[model samples]
Target chain A: MGNLNPIQILVDTVSVGGLYALTALGLGLIFSVMRLANFAHAELVTCAAYAVFALSGQPVAVAIVASVGTAMVLALATERLAFRPLRSADQTTMLIASFAVSMFIQKLLIFTVGSRPKPVDPLPILAQPIAIAGAQVSLLKLATILACIACLGALTYLLRRTSIGLHMRAAAEDFTMAQLVGVRANSVILAAFVLSGFLAAVVALLFVAQTGFVHPRLGVQIVLVGFVATVIGGLGSLPGAAAGGFLVGALATLLQALLPAELRPFREAFLFLIVILVLLFRPNGLWPAPGLKERV
Target chain B: MTAYAAAPHAIRPAERLSEIWRRSATLLVLIAAIALLALLAGQADAVLQRRVIFCLVNLVAVVGLYIFMGNSGVLNFSVVGFMAIGAYTSALLSMPAAMKGTFLPDLPLWLGAMQVPHMLALLTAGVVPALIALLVGFPIMRLSGIGAAIATLSLLFIAYIVLGNWDSLTGGQGSLMGLQTYVKLPVAAAVAGGAVAVAFWFQETRWGIALRASREDEVAARASGIRIPRVRLIAFVLGAFVAGVAGALFAHFQGTLRVENFYLDLTFLLMTMLVVGGSRSLTGAVAGTFAISLVTELLRQTEVGVTLPGAAVTLQTPAGLGDVALAGVMLVIILFRPNGISGGREIDEMWRRRAGRKHRKLPEERNA
Candidate 1:
């Protein structure tokens, strides 16, 4: 373990965490406004990956645009079709419906593209590597980190500065009050979904670039991770989700590095155990909302 | 309580008889039809017998789901994971040494050293999952609403990841094989029937009533002195036990098991069955299971040459198109009639009413 490359590990962890944070931000945004978990967020990520793969022959900018656009469409469609009707229904109904939609979209993907995982070619810009702090890191890793930071900065700016962002925050705080203030609650919610979708697209590209493949079931895995991150950071809190995502990612990487050779395969289980502990002790999450009573 | 005494004793005796008649009629008819079909279609080949056994295996799982979802209003997404635990446990216990050694060479020295009887192995299988559920449910039951669901989903993911990676015990991605297939149709059906009966009896008990009340209004139930978490834990453990039994049956019936087969897809299917069948009634559970299974089978079978007019489509479908379609339909039903097919009413309730009507008519005729 001592002989392992520390610099490489740090770089890798940051890159991975950046991707998770980006994806989680989108998921968190939708959750904050709509109070729906958006289980299909991972599928939007996958759709982005597919979009990139399909447009790989084009310039990198076009490919990225295509991926993000595809995810936006998915986000809007999911909100309009699956969630809007259930907005007034009980929480359980919406949760179940989300699960159903997840299944539907996952199976539809399976039907369209066989169940097998497909290799996705990374863009040429992602291929170049740069040596930093005695560690060789792919240019894409740096780009992903920068992209995540830039997007988060933009999101923070939108939320704190812009009128629409203020409306979104208002809706998040109290939907009825926001509506009374002449905020189009539904449109604000839709905007959150769109933003989340775009974030998922970016994360999807990063994931495929890192993992090299995408499958129908990939979304389920991502959604679970996103959910865990959201819970750990505190549900309905965007910054917390980002922080949680990075924390989980860092912890997972450290655990992997520190684990005895024989227990290396159980790395994920160990990480989840940590999550369980966090949940058990702090049911409201690491960064619970101030002055807000958590519902049982 | 005084209202009971106000009812005439003579009328009670007549009502009891009528209730029995009403409750048993549908079950009796269904049983007779099945029996007749079994007799007429005598000596069904091994493949068809296996298919029937498979349906019964699913029936057991759906019934297990009915106990919690039907009575408690908890959407338990971890049943499939519990089933996986049961399947892998049974598979490890029942596998021949040669097969076990070949696939799971890294199995612990003690486990590799001994071979257990198949029946004991199967029993251990069911017990193991139940025990795990009991342990897990303690903390999980404290969570309410979507929190519980998320916790259970976490459990499912953890179980699946463990099962998939734990190559020593489960053979990992490689299918667990070489188990003796002892799950005949009659045995599977009998087990399923027994599960339904147990669930039915449980539903009538005090604990069941408490659980139902909690489901209706947790605050009111708590105010009424119901230990909500304990009741939920009991439901979770019991449901998990039934799922384990189903898994054991499924493992033996298929003669092999794979971790992937019992993960998210199967979990969704089970949830669909419970929801589509009406999460509030035992009859809905059984009916939903049979209906979904038969429809799935029919769709898979009919995927040959059917095509719709004015569509550039073929009737050809994949292996589990029926399940996908059923899930979609169930989603629609959930959207429109969230109470499900039978809502909360059991078949026995309808039968009791019909029997009471018949008894009243008999008295009228006698008087005439």
Candidate 2:
């Protein structure tokens, strides 16, 4: 392994890790209330990415608003049309439904836009390399880190201060009990979807900026990484999801920097091995929500 | 004779076997009919024969899924992973020595020197993956529901990474070509039928019943002294063996195997087929496979369309339409009939229902 600067690696970790953190946050939010791990969240990110690319000729502000709006609408519609009907269904059933929905959207995009990746240099400014203490960093990475913090900060504020947030927290804690005590289930669930959708849209935009292209099959890796992060942090815990995301992202990028060139391709394999070890030790995850035991 | 028609005096072992046969008669007949139909089609058109054979091979794999996911009520995502192992094993064992030398130069000396008969390779193919499953399926089966899903998914990832990167043995993401094509229509039919019989037999076993009990409710199964993990593991290994056999058949059918063929796409398709037919019954596995296969073939045909009344109009079917259609159908089935088209009931059960009898909800779920 060649020596890499510690500062550069840290920057890489924070930037990449922040995207994963946002992804895990969305998953954790939806899971907290519905107890359904939304497999379609990643697909939603792809949708937003495509949205931005489709609106390339438009002003950046218009594109951002459109892409974010598209993701939120799609999220809400899926919630209303697909998931809401299966609200009381078994976890597996809902999980499978989400899988079907995700695949359906992905395949639809492939058919419509073609599966090939298309170059999308939407924001040249975000891509410029900035020298940080004699280390080069992409402006997008720094922006991603900032965006992640802002989203998390906003979520905390909403969960702590607002009535809707209080209702959401209650529902997450005990869905039936919250409803029994008069928390409006519909609005709270909808809000969760909207918030998560926003996060996905944000992730999608950043992903496009970093990758410089949009492919029909993109976002799967992102979603899977996010999912692993969520599980590692604590499946149902919000803070845990973010922490897990950041930690896993950091570890991944660090591995990329540190691994021998010949062994670089197997980095994911090494990462998964560590994840399996962690689960064996702490099956409930690193930061499990209080009082929740694996019943099965 | 129906199980209902059996002597009511005592549940003798001989009579129980007869009753079991009777209960599964409808499903067995349907499978036999499919075989007969395949043979008949093979007489008429060559391409149709090939398609039917491919579908039958897939049917065997889906049935394997039912044994594990259906019985234990846990979805095993690493099924296609096991199939990859089986396929590679079979491919390596039976490939012409010269081709093996060329394709997989890094193979061990003895293995590279050896060239087994197709029959022997097929048998070994089933055994190897099953043995692997026996050794490694424990920590996975210990977790249930979401935990199991994640674990098995990770298992799939691990398997893909290993198999994909193990260039020495698996041809390193390239096609492992020049394998013998020993799978014929009759052979595929026989394998598929045997798979159906094996799954049905397994479900009648005590372990299968216990696993199903655990599926309905875990605490109660434990209270009744059912060792959930052991039973689930047994089902898992057993399922992997059958899936391995299916994989071996798949390798022989394809004649050239690729690592990319056995991953997320097929894994999810197998799962969808299992879920669509109903994950609860053997008939569900068979029905789901055939139904989805038919839908897919029909959609693929649309990629070369039929002339309409107004004009010789043919809609240009886009890429991945078949998968899209299938996923849409799965979503509809999940929303409307979450248990699947069979609702966990077997074909014979439907016959029994039509014979003027009330259906028995699975006993454990009755009180709930």
Candidate 3:
């Protein structure tokens, strides 16, 4: 573990970084459009994970489809039922409401499914180690990197080229102004939720493949890391979210490789300390979004 | 911003006295309510009495949370982190030398040999966390809105990791046991009442008022020459002090400490209490803790299958329903009453409004 193999470290960093980036995008998309932090985004990831586990008996394709469908439906439902009512309320209220939704789903999952983690191997093939440049990297890591790039590229295309995507971008830039200019608030928001749900579903698949288990809290830690990435990247910036995720992921991996054995257990503490230091220097984040600056 | 700012010079001495007297009513009412609950629990079985003590501990923590979040309008997620710091600090200080020697054998001689009085230990608990908060808040409080919240959340995770992994000092995730359990209902209630009074007093001060002004409109507050970050840092440190005391109370109450206790679950539980009551006012913090504790108690009873006095049926509820119901209640309250059940007004405000309505037949006097 002490050996500093460049290829292995690079693969590990990119794989972890890619997953976090996807998670950040899912959260960042919603925050950009609605100004809601959407703590319930964790529930979307968890529901998708559970769906895959529950449908593991089915064909792999069916399990994947069901999980993706589950995340999307749950995301839409939460937006409709919990968030829509608080649209006119302040940001703090929305954040708390989302927290309640997240808790409700987590507890409900525990009530029905129990808190113990259940192992599921929906894709054993991806776990196989493949030789790459004198380093043994799991096929899952390669797949994760590919998936992250594909999703980000596809999302960028959608935002740049499509009418609905343009509407979303406009809304994110300025909500009230976008409404005045004829962007449909409801549909654009719904589209954002759907796309976020798709990203979360992808994250769930990749995360479960790596961890080999599904549990109620599978999403809690990752979602928090994602939320932190979103903030450090720049709250309302898509590309910034990606950058923050990669930065956090790379730092964490590097810390894991470099810290002494006794200090390794404190890696997250060091990571968070660095995050605070970053914010101290750049209070607005590394790539602050336009229109987010505090104005007199 | 000027309209919302406190009129420091407008009130005459007599009027200021009356206004202070009126605000005291809120603190008095809160204290009386807490005393009433403690009194009732005193007569109940040990279990219920313990639960009430725990509620009061939560009240202290939530009120500490309110001191910063209510006034500054920034969600602080690191209160539990401060609480963890407090708990560990208190436990390490108050534990008997023999116990410490056995558990934390590798401890430095000066720290390991010390065995302080419980009160002194508790005071140190509050002081240490406040010092830590002063250091952490200096940088983090400069960021507003989500940036601040995220930074504080990281603080919490950092605390959890450090406490969980510091094996020599913290017993490495195993419980730190055999501490003096001095937090009886009276001790807890006294601290809770004291926290309420401190919260009220702080919010009425110039710094607190300026913080609230910043909370309402940051740009306007900045334009009015208020230093937002300084006031925020003040409240953050003071709030950490209160949270640390609450943590000490929790440690003595439980007679054991675990890093897990001072993590996400406690963080969210205290948050629910603060927000469900109202994060903007002291009354909201107290009321939310009281209401949620009552609801959770009932749910827990039902989960254990409560039997009526003479009925044959047992009212059995599935386990884990308490958490789900608490979350649901918080969701409903946040939706229907975003300012909480207190609506962000103090008890004195509600009282004055009633009196004002009654005096409508006469010519109106200037409102304080």
Worst 10 residues of 3 chain B by lDDT: B359-368
Which runs of model 3 end up more than 4 angstroms from their true locations? A294-296, B1-9, B357-368
Report the lDDT tens digits of candidate 3 across residue range B144-223. Answer: 77677778989999989998999988897999999899999989998999998888888878899889879878888999
Prediction 2: B-chain TM-score:
0.92
Local lDDT at B96 for model 1: 76
A1-296, model 3: which lDDT tens digit per residue?
67588999998999999989999999999999988898888989999999999999899999999999999999999999999988877677787788889999998999899999999988888989999888999999999999999999999999999999999999888888899999999999999999999999999999999999999999987898888788778888899999999988898899999999999999988878877877888776688777775445
Provide fnat values for all models in the order shown. Answer: 0.31, 0.60, 0.82
Which regions of candidate 2 deviate over 4 angstroms?
Answer: A1-3, A294-296, B1-18, B308-316, B358-368
Model 2 residue A108 lDDT score: 80
A1-296, model 2: which lDDT tens digit per residue?
Answer: 24487777888888888999999999999998998889999888999999999999899998899989988998999999899998988777778888888888888888788889988866778878898888887788888888888988999999999999999889888888899999989999999999999999999998899888899777787998888898788888888999999999888987888788767777887777666666767776899865355344
Clashes, model 1: 1
Model 2 per-residue lDDT tens digits across residues B101-164: 8988999999998888887887788889889888778766787777777777777787788888
TM-score, chain B only, every model? 0.84, 0.92, 0.94
Pairs in clash, predicted candidate 2: none
lDDT of 2 at A132: 88
Candidate 2 iRMSD, 1 decimal: 1.8
The share of true interface contacts that also appear in candidate 2 amounts to 0.60
Query: What C-alpha lDDT values do all the predictions have?
Result: 0.76, 0.84, 0.89
Which window of ten consecutive residues has the lowest lDDT sum in model 1 chain A? A287-296
Q: CAPRI verdict on model 3?
A: medium
